[model samples]
Target: MAPRRCPCGTGLTYDGCCGRLHDGTATAGTAEQLMRSRYSAFAVGDPAYLLATWHSSTRPGRLELDPDVRWTGLEVLGTTGGSLLAAEGTVAFRASRLDDGVPGVQAEDSRFVREGGRWVYLDGVPLR
Candidate 1:
């Protein structure tokens, strides 16, 4: 089968985008990239990857994605700072999901920080 399209909305195959990050062959180089990969993780139902990429500072003891919720798409609204050369950044995005056939959208402005040369999600504030 052809490689699946990335759920991150990058218009690239999974392997060429978030799959490499999910499978340990690559790391996101910027806050936006990291944000995209996180959305992919949720879309793919990999809560482990989500926790693994969370900043220790704000990471919770555990995370669980509702089994009924199926992520469908991601749309990055904007970003600032978090680059290979920057220590922190914020990404504003909206993600669509369907739970029990009920469609919904979640929007947030998420914070990210570079630690040990990798970007980790710190936290997020909901957006309207």
Candidate 2:
């Protein structure tokens, strides 16, 4: 398969967007970077990276990907307190997708926590 593109439709390629980070070239030094990379992982079906980046406490054993769903784009609206060594943080964004005969968006405010010197995705609290 060809390399994936970011959900943001940047046309820059996933490697340029987040693959590099997941591949270990560029580390997600900030919460925002980690958040974007996580989104890119989802778009590319890289569940291993997702599981690896998720906090162990909250990490699930599997990520269930719907076969009919296609993630369209990612629009990160904002983030707060994701600085290095912070205990916790939040990322707010809009993730667009097409699934089950419907095209729509999942606007969410996701939470994260720093553990063992890394940031891990916890879950999201949707904001309508």
Candidate 3:
């Protein structure tokens, strides 16, 4: 069987892209990379990876993904900072999904920060 493509929209296989991050074999080098991996986590239904990458300041006690929602695509609109040496950054993206067969898109400007030398998700501002 062929390897599955990464849902983060990177032109790479899941294992070569977000899967390595999700499985702990690698760590995200930048905030944008972390953000993409998080989107892939949601697409693949792995809440554990999502929670693990969440910043401690904003992480919830637990996460429950809606089984009826299927993530279809991720488009990174822009980025500011969040590089390998930066302590913080923001990613603007639009994520497409289907909720019980209803199509929808979520646009947000998400913030990220470096914690313990690893990038982690901080929070996001919903875009109108």
Candidate 4:
């Protein structure tokens, strides 16, 4: 069987794309990349990766992923800043999922920051 593509809409194999980031072998180079990997983390139910990539200043004491949510798709809407030399950035996207057979979508504009030389998720503001 062929490897599945990443949920981040990157058109690359999961192993070659977000999987590398999840496994600690690669770090996100951009805010969009971090957003993608974070989405992948949700899809795979890996809270450790999710928390690890979150900015400490905004990180919650604990994370509780909904096991009932089955992620289905990802669509990136836009991005700002988040370059290798930039300190802050934002990525807007829509993530679709199934909540116990009911379809739902999560649209948000996420913020990111570089802490200790690596990109990490800051927070998200809903797009509604």
Candidate 5:
């Protein structure tokens, strides 16, 4: 069987992309990479990966994904900093999903920062 494509839309195999991060074999090299991996986590239904990559200050004690919401696609609109050398950064994206069979799109500009030299999601501002 062929390897599944990554949900991050990186055109790479899941194992070569976010899967490595999800499985703890790799760490995000940038904030944007972390954001993409987080989205992949949601698509693949791995809340543990989500919580592990989340910043401690804003991380919830537990995360429960709504079963009715099915992630469909991801579009990265823009990014700032979030480079291998940057300490902080932001990623703007629109994530498409189906909620109870209803189509929806969530747009947000997310913030990220390096903690212990690893990129972690901090927070996000919903875009209208």
Candidate 6:
């Protein structure tokens, strides 16, 4: 993934947006916070973080980053209960991307699960 503007419309890289959260930062105190950082991680092509935060049961074996793709912004549309001790939860959002050729959005109703003290992304329902 190429470096690109953040949701704030700043030229700063996504690594600068929420990468800190994945790097031992204590900024993420809630599921929503973690969700935002995960989005930023996707934007920055930080598969390591994505995997680390993912619950082992649902985590994929690997991630393939698109060299030509760039993430533009993320919008958290809604979030339902997913308590710190809960086994499952959901989040709805829209993630915009560009391939240096065409632009598109990935709207999803994402599912999550808590294992130990971490929240891992499960599958999601894509909303075109």
Q: What's each prediction's TM-score?
A: 0.96, 0.83, 0.98, 0.96, 0.98, 0.78
lDDT of 6 by residue, 1-128 (tens): 78755543335654565656667664444566667778877776788888888878778899887878888877888888766656677888888899886898889988877667667777789876
Off by over 4 Å in 6: 1-17, 83-87
Q: Candidate 5 lDDT (Cα, whole model)? A: 0.96
Which pairs of residues collide in candidate 5? none
Candidate 2: tens digits of C-alpha lDDT, residues 14-104: 7787878778787777777788888777777777888889988888978877777778888888898888767788989998888876898
Per-residue alpha-carbon lDDT of model 1 for 71-119, expressed as tens digits? 9888899998987899999999999999888999999999999878899
Error of 6 at 122 (Å): 1.8
Please list all clashing residue pairs in model 4, or write none if there are none: none
Q: Which pairs of residues collide in model 1?
A: none
Q: Tens digit of lDDT per residue, candidate 4, span 1-128?
A: 99999877789999999999999999998888999999999998999999999999999899999999999999999999998789999999999999999999999999999999999998999998
- Against the true structure, candidate 2 has what lDDT? 0.80
User: Top TM-score: which candidate number?
Assistant: 3
Q: What is candidate 3's lDDT per residue for 65-118, written digit by digit as tens?
A: 999999999999999999899999999999999999999999999999988889
RMSD of each: 0.9, 2.6, 0.5, 0.9, 0.6, 4.3
- Model 3 clash count equals 0
Could you tell me the lDDT of residue 127 within candidate 5? 89
Candidate 2: regions farther than 4 A off: 1-5, 8-12
Error of 5 at 40 (Å): 0.3
Candidate 5 segments whose C-alpha is farther than 4 A from its true place: none
